[model samples]
Target: MADHRRPPPDILVIGAGLAGIACALDLSRAGLSVELLESSDGVGGRMRTDRKDGFLLDRGFQVFNTAYPQVKRRVSLRDLCLRPFTPGLLARTSTRLVRIADPIRRPGDAASLMPGRVLSARDLAALAALTTRDVLLPASILKRLPDRSTAAALTRAGISLSAAEELLRPFLSGVFLEDELETSARFFHMVWRSMARGNLCLPAAGIGAVPEQLAAGLPDGTLRLEAPVVTVTDSGVLLQDGSERPASTIVVATDGPTAACLLPGLTVPDGRTVTTYYHAADTSPLAEPTLVVDSSRAVLNTCVLTEVAPSYAPPGTALVSTSVLNDDRPGGEAVVRRRLAELYGTDTSAWTLIGAYIVEDALPAMVPPWPVSRTTRFAPDRYVCGDHRATGSVQGALASGTRAAREVLADLARQ
Candidate 1:
């Protein structure tokens, strides 16, 4: 028989996603007995990977920015074996495909930008100024700027309406998973700054490798998978199987909806949905790892993943990933494949449909007046942390976890 009077762990973090893993690691490193529980069979809640017919298909199209401060602090870059995408976008117009490369990252490609091709000279200058201001200035200043819709910010920054519709709208729609571009201007600036300062890449294995890497660094016996936590009480968590695990502290690190279900009265913000379709072909359509956006707003974005990392697909075959804002249509995959054919100017009918994943709660919507950071200390010894509590990004999740850990550490010291 087990003894119920046994002392509980110092901290119990629910959800083995990046947030929970980060918090557990921080507390454990400080000589505290930490127990991390995950409901799923494995780690990485949304950042999951699936294998189909010798192809690596990520749950959704996700990219890692090397400039995230929390990522650099927690995970080692070289270990993931990242492959970077070209620092520009190829916009598919009705007539032809236009390539726009960043002058800072691809200096040689910048020379191909003829005046009035994508943007007029004045609009290009305005874009350069916006990039310089966001990338060069400290983040503190960008955060202090008034919060507004990203569309409004572009207008205020002198980006012409045509440029906004042609260049920024389709590209950013994929980033935010919305066509309105109503995300917070501050959040947009931070994302742009991160992109400007870092390489956009994917792990050789998959996006799931990120959380797996974080979980690997934890102390032995610190993490437990397949532990579905149903309720989060003051003392600790109640497992679905009627097992009670007590702890001195608790942190709900699950997604917004799951976190809200566990903790009553917690408000779960509305989330954005996205769908990704994977296709395999005999030959590569685009020979570069450049993201292609439909200027006509037909599809979100498409990229040949094999161009970035040949390991993503089997030898002699190319893997392409196409993402569209989730509409919950009955035959969305067929529509996506047809659009791919039009975008790549190739016959996608022969391309094998590898997989289609529709993530309902892809990310929390970050409209104007969204908080970049939120209080993790919900109650004295109780807390909550996820991308929902802050900006909806990997950086947000890791940062919120780090903040929760600090809060727990400080509260424990006071006791």
Candidate 2:
């Protein structure tokens, strides 16, 4: 019998975001030598945290849908803290504001929600179809589905044209972050499955703490910050400070466009921006911590924050997150604050403006022709990973990292 102990690796992981961290941690656990290099001064790329004048702010306001696997495995519910969304909702329809309390754990919640006052019988039927028949339809070839994406399916199902534009399209765009025609048909099905499980959640402390905690768990010196990687050679990466580091395997886990620049033949299919206006003084502008969405509004689609997470703000202060959709961000911080005042009313004076986190290229293409598919999967030794690599969320980044780590583990197993 052979004494089979696997050989160690000079493993290199590029970018220190969640994906890179995940890969490094897993690889280290497997007894492989792992090094995670980050371009920024610290870890957590898009999910970076900003602390100034007493506020913990994430570079972008991200809401993790319940679909993530890390929620069960990696993300320690004890470390940072978390708050799940309520089953019911509060939606700002054109004519009325509907408050569906207990949306997550309730029945007939949608039926009981208000705002549908403006909806016609056709609109109601279409809304039901979008959630039930269209988005949730099985993507399997064995399961027959309507011809179009949820938006198109609604149209095919005799949903009135006005309803699609005024209601469904706006609501869907906020979630998909793209126009109805551009979104992939399959993505909605995934969302439906997650929604059936639960709504969403926010870190009880701050978004930055989640990524920071993961980094803390890794062996010391595994993660290196401010290591600007100019270009990733087949063997390893060339640093900006005029040093080259080599390893048996490398993972490009930087931002999408940034990754494209680092690796040849990587193109960003489509991009989107997420703009947030932070008011440090506004603690309780809205009566509840529900996600405020106005289907009739175009630019400023949705708003949510750490209202439920009491520790996120000062004793009576609040941090409000407002998102404007576009390939190009409209204006700077001033524009966002103006919109906040317009939507939430003067009562917003309770909170002061602490920071403005504008993620120019927020979400990568989770739809298709899937963006991840086009990236030439740099074979056996070299690799790429990020939110852009998998499903485009914190979980995607983690899963992609775990995937790359497993790849290295397999090679070790063989060695």
Candidate 3:
């Protein structure tokens, strides 16, 4: 059972998530014998999708930004058949629903973005200035400018506290899975730049399709699912079934916590939690594929998923997805329903609750002074990489994986 008769693989990647898949692909591309092991039944750690009653429920509310350089390099957007959300979002204020469309993209809605109760002239100018700077300047310039909490950066940019609380906070809280806006300003600006340059989209299949595509490109027998690794040593890894598989190199490409578990003394940042609730309705609430946020902060954000991707639901049915920052307290769904009704201006008494997914480690908490990218070289033969080592985004995960492969290749060349 030790498989001692066979030669060891050149590289062993413990995890088949995006990072591991990317790493294994690159390593194999360099003609190295690589083996990727995953404990789960399938890949796509947090990006899995499930089919329930003819509805496709993504493990969490996730979107793909078309502008990420790694994504453009690795993923086939045209093949994914991406469906874009409306260019802007709607915020439900106390008196009325406010629409802030991208005037440059949607000139027709430029009038709708005029100064209003929620966004004053000062707020408008500040927002415009911030957008222009983020969009026009190189990311290196922004990362080097200064680091602070997002709240302070908003104030520094001249965004009014009221405007931030009403619009930016509610919208970004869902994105970062934090309410206090304590995330790093460097991360916020990078996200802002991506948003300005890209369109947020969902694949026609589901978010899981992204990983499935990456895994599909791997060499045969390079990936092994359901192979749980219990221990990792300098020489090889021990499997849960008491089998030992040796390798010349090992990369801990799992999530932050799992990687820490396998590699003792590894330090990982705190993580953020989020829960997404899916509800099925007979009729669609919003005709357009736009996101709706409650200024009251009752729920982070909600959208009609069926509007964006019809394949997510069966014929004649509408699927709505709502997300909360953390594991909602007991009886929170009722409150969310009431808030959704208010935001959509419709009755939800008859809507059917499909599923609620709680992701305890939705993303790594990116506080100030956090390195935008961390070195993946854990040791001469051991390496670690994931979103935790970089910013929390698809771009981060893939870039970390690519970086890990490059390091591994360099080390092997020396050997």
Candidate 4:
């Protein structure tokens, strides 16, 4: 049932995902008559909640870092009510479990990055120096180079090979979500800036709340749920149910390819899939709420479930989520379980597998020099928005949405 009684908007926003919501939120705040549309029944898109027998689970385990500048500027953390995790991480090496901490804070713990484990002092130093290069000297430093892969530039800067895999690879690759060798150093630096910002926290309620909040503050008739947008012609936009939504501007605020579909021949990257593995456990295997990585395993990274948001799980339960890279893994559950046993010294028989979402084609293939020429590719009156448009992750999506809004506004002002 479509809510077609409302008046058409000055700006029609397609897709109700985080990016779309963020754009709509800002546009409406500016007093623009905006109408947001969603293909799905819910507003959150990939970020909706799943209510089970008693537990409220997220579509995927989503974490927000204090580093995301757009999130901090756009929404208040207190309003959403986030839960913070412990500052340290638990890294499980082959021999034993190790708790890594900032030496200044936890002086009692192991002094090295690996923590509670022995490393060749030389390797440790190399790793530390490599991190300093990636973290401190990010994209802003490489602004001069408009064209070149950042990974190669890092190598040129003398980041050692072993150091790349052991240290830089784990951190940078996880942040960028792809092959280390191919990524641009500029993008790497962008990720580093985020890392330098602050703590990483997940929503106590659910990631969907973030978008829901954005959509909530909108005035009545500003949003249309379950409205499948069919086309974006020269005059205006079209709806799925044979209705035309004519507007001064149409925001193609959708994932990369989805936008391309509406406005044919839009040149965006081919989307890739991601598998999010959620394991509910009686006790968390990893220490603290910090993120863990196994570079050798190609398992992007894992985080402590209970530490970030205690409410994610019911009484005495821990929620573990692992987000894979661009490619899809068929047997993610079994693979995650095997990896868990290898690290935690336990089997999957004990833990309850609550949610395992596999977006066969989740995000677009971002092969660095990202934030590509989306402005040129999209239709004149309709702008695109999503993680893949500019950057990736929560902040990336936020930025994309804001960018779309800004672009649309500029066009309107000129007209």
**Model number with the top TM-score:** 3
The candidate 2 region of ten consecutive residues with least summed lDDT is 1-10
- lDDT (C-alpha, whole model) for all candidates: 0.88, 0.64, 0.90, 0.68
Reference-based TM-score of each model: 0.97, 0.82, 0.97, 0.86
What is candidate 1's lDDT per residue for 149-264, written digit by digit as tens? 99999999999988898889989999998998999999999999998889999999988899999999899988888989988876678888787898868999999999989888
lDDT of 2 at 209: 72
Looking at model 2, residue 250 earns an lDDT score of 77
Candidate order by lDDT, highest to lowest?
3, 1, 4, 2
**Residue pairs with backbone atoms closer than 3 Å in model 1 (clashes):** none
Q: How close to the true structure is residue 200 of candidate 2, measured as C-alpha lDDT?
A: 74
Backbone clashes (count) for model 1:
0
Clashes of 4: 4
> Residue pairs in steric clash, candidate 3?
none
User: Which one wins on lDDT?
Assistant: 3
